[model samples]
Target chain A: MQAQLIALDWGTSSLRAYKLGPAGAVLEQRSLACGIMHLPIEPRDIAGIYCTNGFELAFDTACGDWLDAQPGLPVIACGMVGSAQGWSEAAYRNTPVDVASLGQALHCVRSLRGVDVHIVPGVIEQVGLPNVMRGEETQVVGVLQGLGTQVLIGLPGSHSKWVEVIEGRITHFDTFMTGELFAVLSKHSILGRTQQPCDQFQAEAFDRGVQVALSKDGQRGVLSTLFSARTLGLTAELSPDQQPDYLSGLLIGHELAGLPDHARHKPIILVGAAPLCARYQRALALCGFAHVSLAQEATERGLWQLAVAAGLTQPVTEA
Target chain B: MQAQLIALDWGTSSLRAYKLGPAGAVLEQRSLACGIMHLPIEPRDIAGIYCTNGFELAFDTACGDWLDAQPGLPVIACGMVGSAQGWSEAAYRNTPVDVASLGQALHCVRSLRGVDVHIVPGVIEQVGLPNVMRGEETQVVGVLQGLGTQVLIGLPGSHSKWVEVIEGRITHFDTFMTGELFAVLSKHSILGRTQQPCDQFQAEAFDRGVQVALSKDGQRGVLSTLFSARTLGLTAELSPDQQPDYLSGLLIGHELAGLPDHARHKPIILVGAAPLCARYQRALALCGFAHVSLAQEATERGLWQLAVAAGLTQPVTEA
Candidate 1:
């Protein structure tokens, strides 16, 4: 089947692309190590080297480069690639937004090669403190379509997001730096300097961390709780290899604990990479959340929905 | 007066030496950039280079070296110099320990040059989660002698310690990796990547962070709230340079919020370097803490008490 549309999910350290059929189904997919921050070439020329041999390119370059290899097609892109630092800035749409509204808010740009490019706007909440998301909004849109309204969605990644979809609109959301914290702490902190080989997750240690995080009644926050990861190792309560999982549990557990009280009773739609999803699923179960379900290909699905809503692609018929 | 004893406060990055008279007054002091981790010489011969002209010495060699230049006198050391990776291991004393008890627990060793050396023991809390402190015990001991019983003391640093001193004994304490977290997040995390020239503290941004941290009711935790540092920048609510102080205030505010209820009602003794103590003092005041006082020369004063307690130096006669 000839490609009808192209979808891209470009983030800090990765670029994922999907070629879709006329029915909005993914026909072929490609992933690259190139993200916005690590782009070897300048941002202006990124579209030129999209499919080139070496430097990984972002959406505009990838789309322009693909069109250079073949012909033009409608392209939908999301993630950090749409930020002020990306190919073009797609200003964030304020929250309490419906999926259809997000479709109208897509930032459209004509590539130098004349390809139709639409960058989905991220969501921002400015009520108490400012919170923003770029690529995750698309995933949340996908979740909203599948799970209907009044559902809680947990998208776990570098910056995990917990969204509240009330009656088909994103009323509230929060971002947790869980994954990022885990990564930095593992590599740079004193707790990470110990010569422990952490190759895989240890369930026992992770559970202990979850328990400790839950036990905190706001009196002792994560700052104090994190030290226990080191102390547990020093006291022989946790092994070296278990430290990573323990740290992960501590962060994930804290994220789960921070969820609004109403979100806990309902089944949360888990999205993102399979491994992270599984970890969140386990953590949610441990936190008394029993009906958690996974949503695969959320980014692609959301991009397709946005493409259709924006009238860039035809809607898929229900199978 | 000629030096009657020598006291060393050796930690991870620097070494400080003080020469004391019979009355325990510091007659002279020297500081070197050498520490346990960066020793140019082997661990065993550190004593011999104490009074040497170069950084090519560890604690033991420096001591031996100092003795070589003059007659034998008792030497005392505290901090990471006695860590497992230091000159010799001074086992951590269990909590509920008296100020004099730490002196008795000091690890005594003789250098190859036959000079007597005493290393003060750190305190360990093994009740719920294991926590160990190497250098802060000396400061806690000093605070006990100066503040009397039933006082709450905060020794802020890389690993900030909040200790409960009752009747000249260190009963319980908590360690917050506030400074370490600030350093790591500023240098390595995405929240730190924003081009904020954070040389000096920005009071407005710092106050905002403290307010946000205090507003968290254990629901969102620090893991989630930390991202506000980035979002506040992205939304133009905070400038780039304000980020560092904002982050500092957030961590310090969370640390203050986590203090035990009893500790909040009393005058908290703030101990550490001037700038960090000032930051903590401001944060404390923002958190509704009044009557905050500073303790200067805490490490040095603490070492003197331990020295006299261990019979390494003559007891000071109160004027």
Candidate 2:
């Protein structure tokens, strides 16, 4: 019997699923906003359709029937579904993750209907570091396979991750919460009161903030420095457009200040959305990091590649 | 003829008005929550009862009222009333303040009722630095008078001020947004979702957070260290009770980390509400500044001294 391959990259707000042939070629692609948060309790019947015909068909209407039609297909899932609050915790495999040695760490979960469901395992790193990426790791590994070795991939979001790949092996990485900070500061701080929606980043303010971060006084003493942002803006000492940029610079500056000095010289590849990723690249350049590039659809692309490697998908050919 | 003295310490949330005898004795004290935010767009005649009495009252009401009631008594106002959003911007008076020189800063102005009012100038210091205190200089001067000589006075609030006084002179000071950071983090961050009402800070967690802040890594990169609070809490590594302490540690840690080396040797005096001041003192002790003291009514007392120097009222017996 020929087996169909289904790949899923599900996260907090959305989900992307793909169907592939044996050779890992994409046969069809589908996506939905039905993240883990939207799923109904005891959604076994609905979830079954998600694994087979994709979200185009109503999961609630024909999930069971769709599952029956694709009885022999193998399903692979990644992303937040592995979280404690998601489908179930996908037990993590500790780093350094050897792509070839990587195993299909699937949790054979039994749904409310007693149907067996397998969920992929997440990768855990830096025992003391409180960050764990589920779906993104698969994509990172896939990127390594697609673009041969020695790349630094930055996955930016509420919790931004920078993954290091050396010779096709997932070596080490770090996580920074820049996105979340922006959200909090823009909405909660005194800065929030005066902040307006403008894309302009005051280069001068960013430089000054970076200089402050680099000061012998250091970024660790930054809380007191935030008041300077207001002073700089209101008093015309710091340009208004620069407040956001200054905030970004301070955050990025601290990130650099805390980093192991060795990480500074490495070739960097930013894997996230534009504007923000561009901003990180700009800051890194200011900090003297010379080599940096960006990757598009890193998460989805990584998911598809991982699904293929897991013997669950076909290789895609140009349409 | 008898002269009445009035002093007002107007902060963001509440207005504290003191009726003082000529000798700087507290005759009566009253407080109201009608802060600047509660004031009407146009000033109102709200002092009908007190003015009806024969005794002159030195209350820090609206600027207009202070002017209207000016000729009869000396009115000294301190605190946020000097910020740009307040009645007027008081240029910061730098440290090593000569209270004798400060006493000469009284300005005469015509009131709305054609009365002559004496407006005390807000002192400015360290012209280039963002460091400035409007009313706090008077309070710090009072603290110096009451405590004698060199001391570190930490005033905690929406904007926490750390002032260093040397030999009765205000040397230098810095401000930290501890209270504001706590409020923002508790009400707006991802951590806020898990926050419970934290009326009394959990000492253990606060201590632990202080330790975290004391980390070589923590101090060097605190701007980034904030994320650890969320990660630690969300991962359940840190208890919910520890959130506030962690936050307090972040703020206090940054303060301790950024403090000028000179402040380390000075005896610390905390000036604020009982609970918060005590907490700050405790945090300071943990940070190795063990010699700490608390000042009650530092704001009110500071206001009185400034009021007396302005000759708002004649010396009366100590109440």
lDDT of each: 0.80, 0.63
Q: Show where candidate 1 strays beyond 4 Å.
A: A40-72, A217-219, A316-319, B42-56, B60-70, B217-219, B316-319
Compose the digit string of candidate 1's lDDT tens values, residues B1-319. 6666888888888888887776778877878777877775433334344444223345444454456655567788888878887778898889888877888888976655566668898889988777889888888766666564588889898888998888877788898989899988898999878947766669998888888999943238888899999998998888888988898888998888889878877768988889989888898998888778988777777888888887777785444
Q: Mind giving the per-residue lDDT tens digits that candidate 1 earns over A1-319?
A: 7677899898878888888886678888888777877775543344444344222334444455556655757788899878988877898888888866788888977655567578999889988878898988899877676465478888898889888888888888899989988888889999897637656668888887787888843238888888988888888888788888888888888888888778877768999889888888888888898778998888898898888888887786444
Lowest summed lDDT across 10 adjacent residues in model 2 chain B is found at B49-58
User: Which tens-of-lDDT digit does each residue in B1-319 have in candidate 2?
Assistant: 2336556676556667766555566666677664554443333343343242111222323333433444465566666655666554555554557654565565444333444444445554444446556666767756766565778888887778887777766666777766887787778776676655567767777776677777754644554566667667656777776677777776676667667777778788888788778777777888888578877766666666665665654445455
On lDDT, the candidate that comes out on top is 1
For every model in order, what is the number of clashing pairs?
Answer: 21, 26
Candidate 2's displacement at residue A190, Å, is: 1.2
DockQ of all predictions against the true structure, Cα-based: 0.71, 0.45
> Model 1 chain A, poorest ten-residue lDDT window?
A48-57
On residues A259-303, what C-alpha lDDT tens digit does candidate 2 reach at each position? 566567766777666977777777777777777777765554555
Scored against the native two-chain complex, candidate 2 gets a DockQ of: 0.45
Per-model TM-score (chain A alone): 0.91, 0.77
* Residue-pair clashes, model 2: 26
